[model samples]
Target: MSRTFQRALLGLALLGAITTAAAQQYDYDRQEQWQYPAALAQSPIDIQRGVAIDGDLQEVQSIELRDTVATLRIVDNGHAVEVEAHGPDALIRGRHFELMQFHFHAASEHTIDGESFPLEGHFVFKAQDGRLAVVGVMYVEGEANALAGEVLDALGDASEGEIEREDIAIMLPRDKSYHHYLGSLTTPPLTENVEWYVLDTPVTLSADQIAGFNARYSHNNRKVQPLNDRPLVHFAAH
Candidate 1:
């Protein structure tokens, strides 16, 4: 079979397997036939200006946190803050989605009209309100990434049971342009109503750093959902 045909067949097989697994439960089979609109739910937050997503594209000085809910300390360009993970239990304040352990999705989860890239990172955030906000960042092959190197290095000793503390920066794209839309969690549960923000800018990753992530989560990303009726708000950096 042709390479394209083989890929399509493989994709179909994976879908079938996923469908079978999701069917053994009582929940509706959302994974089998899911779709996302080309846009997002109309929210009060201006899809254009949700927050200031700009700064010198520098790595955070350090990161420190425990796995209990995993409050990650992310510093970027000298700005430091703690990112607490509530697991699937912590409430997302206004929404019903709960926190799922944050992991990296090299290349990216969603693509631009079916175009996949080298790497994407996903910060899965679920809200009790049955809503989810996934922060997606794409990565392009380039210079050595200090921040990514640190995190990847820590993953070596990142204990399973409890969250561990590590100091490293979360580097981001210089142009904070992002695309916001409504979609579903790329992973299991495949729940809908997910508010997705695809940063227009992609970060850099060394060949070695990319290999390190692949060591653990080799292609652990869900295929892009169909943009059904969802609207996507593409924003530019200020």
Candidate 2:
């Protein structure tokens, strides 16, 4: 080949390598190496039921869910299925945080006594000051979940649709008991200072419903991080 042609081939090869590297940067396999601040606090920590201290937060923390129909946009964002909307807000330890969006993770991120569930849903809320509070609910294999079914059907097909407020409200456990801690987001940027409430009571979803999500994004969960010296408090349900 001529000198000009040889140089062109080399340039193309370099560009391809760069693109491939950028794509794999956020891949779950490379998560351990992902960069974050020196806070030493990360998320998806295992909830050691035996070590958690009990507390009563029913009065201070509440989830205000509207009883009206709302439009939600569901997207299969290549990584996980995410539903975006507004209205519901949660009060965490007396601080107000608006529900921004929610998404799913397979095999769960947080575990209870080292046990992983079939599926986990994260309800991300944000305060006006930009602080975040996430409520996590685990799904056990049993009766099919209507909301999960609707979200799965919309994935890779429909984007926008109407859903009842009750459907969203049902995702949260009625008991209101949860394990609270300070952690970071499971996804990249892995921002810290996020308040987490992993509900003690898990909801139910059929085997098929869980499989449907797995088929799209089989494993999108980040490995559990160290609990460090952070306190893990279990808020009792009244």
Candidate 3:
């Protein structure tokens, strides 16, 4: 079979599998598909401006990262395209947290001043004490991203498995300033007590790059949850 044709078939098959699984009792739109949605402390919220900046939102001076390659496995859990990678042993807020994996949701989850982006990338982290933290980066449609391009280049076909791109490099944008808030997991279990740091600056990707991802797992983000009187802080990173 041709490469493009194989990809199309794979996408259809994956979608079919997801549908069949739901037949066993699962809601494609709800987390876990078995329990009621949480009323508070949900993630992927609409990050509004002018919110009171309470505590200090600090970051590590640097997180050890490699360039030549970003070792990540592209996984499709019938939801979103996630990347599993070797973690950079990092720390934040005086606690050491390791980068577990990162994933993308087209049409973004969180919004800024009530506006959503074309894409949202979430970096999930965990500490030894079982604490969780996430760094969210929003992406717009424009020029291609150097680091992201490397990952995209690997998607010649829609094969689902661990995808390790040897040429791709891990990078953090120069504009590290971010908004800090407390939220929960956007997916199943709806786990709360996560420290969320959303990068204030957004990255840009070419139109085709955005379309490529959309074609695969088009819109997988959860709805924007309520802030619920929680305090949000902004870090200038001076």
Best by TM-score: 2
Q: What is the number of backbone collisions in each predicted candidate, taken in the order shown?
A: 37, 0, 2
**Regions more than 4 Å wrong, model 3:** 1-38, 57-70, 161-171
Clashing pairs in 3: 73-163, 74-163
TM-score of every candidate relative to the true structure: 0.55, 0.85, 0.78
Model 2, span 1-238: residue lDDT tens: 9999999999999999987776675588778677887547999998999888876544565444453244577876657788886776766677777888899998899999999998899999899999888989999998887777877776645544445443577666688778999999988678899989999899998899888889877788988888998999887766
What is the Cα-based TM-score of model 2?
0.85
Q: Which model is ahead, 1 or 3, in terms of lDDT? A: 3
Clashes of 3: 2
Which candidate model has the greater TM-score, 1 or 2? 2
Roughly what TM-score does model 3 have, to 2 decimal places? 0.78
Candidate 2: misplaced stretches above 4 Å? 1-22, 56-69, 156-166
Model 3 Cα RMSD, Å? 7.7
Tens digit per residue, CA lDDT, model 3, 135-231: 8988888788765665565545655554455432333556667788889887765678888988888888888888877877676778888899988
Of 1 and 3, the candidate ahead on TM-score is 3
